[model samples]
Target chain A: MEATVALIAEHFNGALSPTFFELITFANKLKIVTQAKPTIVMLGEEIEEVANKATHFNGFDVIAIEVPGLASYNPETYKAVLKSFLEELKPSFVCLVQTSTGADLAPALSVKLGAACISSVQEISSESGRITFLRSVLGGKAQAVFSAMTDITVVSIQPGCFERADTGACSGNVNVSRRAYRSLRIQDLGVRPGPGCDLLLSEAKVIISAGRGIRQKQNLALLFELAAMFSRSAVGCTRPLSDSGWLNSGSQVGLSGAIVSPDLYVACGISGAQQHIAGMQGSGFVVAINTDHYAPIFNHSDVCVVCDVIEFAPELIKAIAKYRQVT
Target chain B: MRILLCIKEVPETDAPIMLDQASRWIRDNNLHCYRMNRFDECAVEEAVLIKEKFPDSILDVVTVGPKRAEKILLRALGMGVDNATHILSEHTGYLSPFITASWIAKFASDKDYDLILTGVISEDNMQGQTGPMIAELLSMPCATSVIFERISYEERLIYVEREIESGARHCMKILLPALLTVQSGINKPRYPSLSKTLRAKKLRIPVICSDALLKVETRERPELIRHPSKSRQSLILEGTLSEKALELAAILDKKSLIK
Candidate 1:
């Protein structure tokens, strides 16, 4: 009997997370390499609609398990339930989006099931004998190819790595069932709203973001000064600035912060880590400034200035202001 | 109360990467240019904060790496961890997260720590697995990406705000004897005091050989390392500094991005 490749469906408060379809598409790619088709495991309290929603788009067997005690994602409840469920099913590959939830679940699940766990997987290469998965390392400065010798492997795929499967029609079977379990050590206190994303940043037509390349916290003032030029503009920073407490958490932009799609984005001194690139990639026009010509940010920008961001910012600020006055 | 904090050393986020036709970042010339994993610094800071509140708390920091790994341990001690352990790993390149977690778990299981904490993920691997894997190996409840936490001393519950998608934080209350992976930016990590650093330097920290311990070999291996194709390539403006700046202004104007 051959094993299975499975994707754990994601839902937030019973509404299906958009990443579910992307997971389906990634799993489909893995299907060709592993010679095993993918199945969808939908678990939560009231996931019928989300599961039904999934089957509508993706044609994979949907195993919808409603655990009576789980209203929201509690890692303990998830590990307790999914471990046995997976043990019985024995999937060769368990795939999930590399969201906070999946990041929490996959490693523990892998340990419980004695499976190998690979995370933030961005690409899959099949020509390399044993289905190797590629993921970023050194903050996306480099990439690594990983493969599992174990029978079971759990992978968390980074968002935006694969094209999402489109929504259309339900072609697969949806098995709706209930599982009985009570969480012992963990209690889900539901969710409180995250920091208010300043409307200035979220609604900005022109957004300027900075990173470590700014040299120091004082350089952030330069980024702000540059932001003052645009009619509707604001300033943001990458995780380093946020982590250093140089800027408030609200102005941070990345997978963990604001995901914005502004009309124009100016990235200064930012190395363009994968997360930061993902956050700002949706911007219509992007210009990046950095000292490191080989900086990964250059790959994602529309216009790249290979210079120290600090030196370029003041000049660009002056140039833009002067140009605006002339025009 | 006893707390166990797991730490890791990683390449500085800004060092020029040496990538070959390549998979992993070859840490050849850049071996000396590394520091404590940024996220783990937050974990150590959080543990220190917890200890400050509960003065009776005993905090221990541990790292699984080579001889150079001790520097991070000493730094943790300087940051106010009560003790440090160096689980010396022989393999220098790409030790599996599972193998790392198992060894740490083996060392931690009998210590009966009331709480355990680790960085949400290592900056290099970004797998974010060791903390949760240790939690599983020890059968302890666990939480990941924890940004804020409080101990309800009398209730003996830890209330936490775990970071989720798009800045949303999922709150949870976990019973004691649990594990948490601390997300960065939760707090400003305190710099090591000179006195503490001197004291930490004088202490004889324990170094346990990883091979001496029961082995949990890696089931996964790195087959190859190569840079992925870029999604987009920027139009680099070739010129002097001021020239590039003027060009940027023109480009933004051309794109109608400037008002």
Candidate 2:
């Protein structure tokens, strides 16, 4: 049967992240009734932006629904309006690429619409009529596959796993429609920047963070000097450092603060707490250095160093400088 | 104030889960079964605490899942809920979350519940959207990640402590008929007492069929494909303890891993 899958293109200042190429690629792989095209539903101008962006990667045809002024994210309004659209279209399958916010809305919207939801899917496919979804569980230690028996199934694809489609251009029709639901009473609380927030915490390409072993706040400069050498990478601290006021609230990285998945995470003098691990766990590559041989971070890091920061920090920075001069 | 606590039965969080040969879904273990989600147990305990405060108010616990979901309702009743309801159906796999929310919302809509409470997220899916979703369907106000709750009868308002960024806490107040999604570690959910378990066995649970709850519309199927094999690019460190430590530090520093 022909399927109409809606991928709610999340809007960030009327634009979409290029990473959503994973969603487009995965959605294109589904087996549906032949002779009918898969319809892509997007809300707001970002839908058009995504449609335009997706064209650059693949010549896939996407029909977009643009709801004007659909700025910011609202689950209730989205679900309400989407429910009405599903009632009219009655697509055979629906899919969403999992992001922090999309993950929250996927299941609830599916329930309100009476659809089976397959969430956090890293892989998806169908044979005959049955659909299978795959994702990792227990902090990426294991893979779990889920299947749905319903005629209509909804899936939320995980981010970062799929290849982003190369930018390409395609032609698509744009339809502007009003969301069916009444205006939401809830207003978005704008992002509030806190005080003493080091500019680095918000904009760092790389982060070198210290944990409990740093021992003293004054010693932070030792780490800062090295951070300066590394293309102005930012210095951050674990909860203990922030709690002790060794670093400002903005510099704290963990469950309670910024859940940064940076390009590279360098953890120093830190005994990795479980909460701390959750925050930095998303890094592309993790290297942890701590004197305590039993530091928990070693379990989670790509590279682990059991060394005292005081002696190692100075010499390591000096050695790097010397190595750079020779190389 | 009357309260409705929605619970769920999920795969044990710590268990080793495997997929079946179809590569379509989780394999069923003949010997093992599901348990009431740990976080929902907290919601039940919170409702129990409120019932203890206003002994005159009623507490109705409801859950929607397959036949096995009765386990959650039975456990809730044994924990001191005045009544229990299970919206029974075989649609438990991928659709369970949505079906459960719809069933609970339908069950709660006609009833007079001063407050609706559920776990912020189930350990199984861990998506943390059902409470707010149901609240939206019912057109009720909803808030998530609450650690503590207080009810003011005189003011007709409920105040709750919510966890925030940087281990901070904030208090929020909402009128009755509000929904609160609870965070873990809010309060310990108690084990059912032997006497209570025995009494629970005698309580009758009304099972509502899926069609009776709400109308559902099905949509797209996710296309599934084979998973790729991953190669670990690993670097092994070896030497005397101090030497290894220093070498590792040097490597990290050179890589700019240690600032």
Candidate 3:
């Protein structure tokens, strides 16, 4: 029987974000899901904690690797420990979905395990026993396909590629084991927080995005005011604004910048470059306000207003303020 | 000191990238196929700078790609890398970070190198896997997203300055015989000279396969899901530029979108 193992974080806190649940959605769709019960390899206590919340779920088995000391992500250790588990189980297919942490570890794990891996895969299908994989390339400008001869395949699906699974009352069998880090040769000095605002890029929902529009640094006040409408949203910008040092580098969104998939994406004065589009392509709704009708952003916008933001700024603010007062 | 800098050959991003109708991928015809990713180029540039700083050190470029990738290696050689090793694998088209790492780690294991370097992430996958993954396979240390730095051979340590959130920069120090993944802005990679390119053409390379290093772990066939093109009716936003602006303001205000 072809057994499939899904490598996921254990903390099943029903509160798993779209990125976390994306793994579950993909795993359930596997052709092997019906024939062979899928098994999930959970790392650390948080993932295990989440798994416990989801033990009643159907469609797969849940195994937790008790690496208590692994409070933070270390690529070397995750690869070593995951590789060891993989070697022991030798599942037909092992899918490692990418989170910020998994993206770091999946490649190293693939190398060590001598496995065929597909990174940032959008979809997978098997026919006549051969599996074909597909992924986006060149900052989402193109997609590529690849096939492997080995029976075991490692893949890290991109976030937002699949419909999220409902976590209510789902359960599966659980297996717990302790991990030995003998395969890992590296040691961590410690986890140093990344530089800047420390804004959680993955969790942002409402975003006020800027581009070449605002014209100058002082013009960012307009974006800040827009962002103030939603408690969950933050301000973002295209590469130009971030590159020119006019805005916080952390808030930049594009292929070279942070990938943001907010519920509401407000692109202001931003000429939508392809590279920039790749980052926010997954946003739920995009509203672009630009003066130029030929701006490429107008082509992709859900709602577009062709007018000068500079001329409309004060009145828009006043109107919203009035609305807020009335409400 | 000996260093193995891993490079990849990717389609130039500046060109108009369009997929062939038959296959669901970009048609790489007349499009320029040369130039490593921006970040990998930065990594190679860092290696060259390191070599210049320490004339006694030797820098070797190694890449796990098809025959076409050798063009990049030769380009690196012409730009001043001593020599290169191409672990030739025909099936590299499906070479994920894991498989690429396996091929690279197996090759690196054979060579006596004091350090390994790669781009923080390739513009292609943007996953940034090889450096850290190879470190795990070889059981070595790794640091990703390094923007600027200098390496010390004597102390076997790397001093790095990286940009992070809020325009903040952090200085980090990591011990070597370690792996380093650099971002594109670190250093602009140089152009290879004609003479160096000629000399590099004569250089010999070694080709290896993943099968020789480890057993077949698995071959996953990922499906290519095309993002359907969405055609939106564009309302050419027009009017007495100022009046149009007011009209747009009224619309935006009605939506409660912008304040």
Best by TM-score: 1
Would you give me the overall lDDT of model 2?
0.66
lDDT head-to-head 1 vs 3, winner: 1
TM-score of each: 0.95, 0.62, 0.70
Winner by TM-score between candidate 2 and candidate 1: 1
Error of 2 at B142 (Å): 5.3
Against the true structure, whose lDDT is highest? 1
iRMS of every model, one decimal?
1.8, 7.3, 6.2
**B43-68, model 3: which lDDT tens digit per residue?**
88888898888887788888876677
Candidate 2, A125-161: lDDT as tens digits? 5557555677654334235556766656667776655
Model 2: per-residue Cα lDDT at residue B239: 59
For model 2, give the TM-score of chain B: 0.83
RMSD of 2: 8.0
Question: How would you encode candidate 1's per-residue C-alpha lDDT over A1-327 as one tens digit per residue?
Answer: 876887888887657887777787797788778888688897898778878777776678889999986888888878888888988888889888999889999998888888889998988978756788898877777778888888899999998778876646457898999898898788898988887677788998889998888878888888889999988889988988887878887888888888888898889889988888778888898888888877788778888888888888888888898789988
lDDT of 2 by residue, B127-159 (tens): 566786678668776667777888887777777
Which is the leading candidate under DockQ? Answer: 1
Q: In model 1, how large is the Cα lDDT of residue B17? A: 62
Model 3 alpha-carbon miss at residue B6, Å: 2.1
Error of 1 at B243 (Å): 1.1
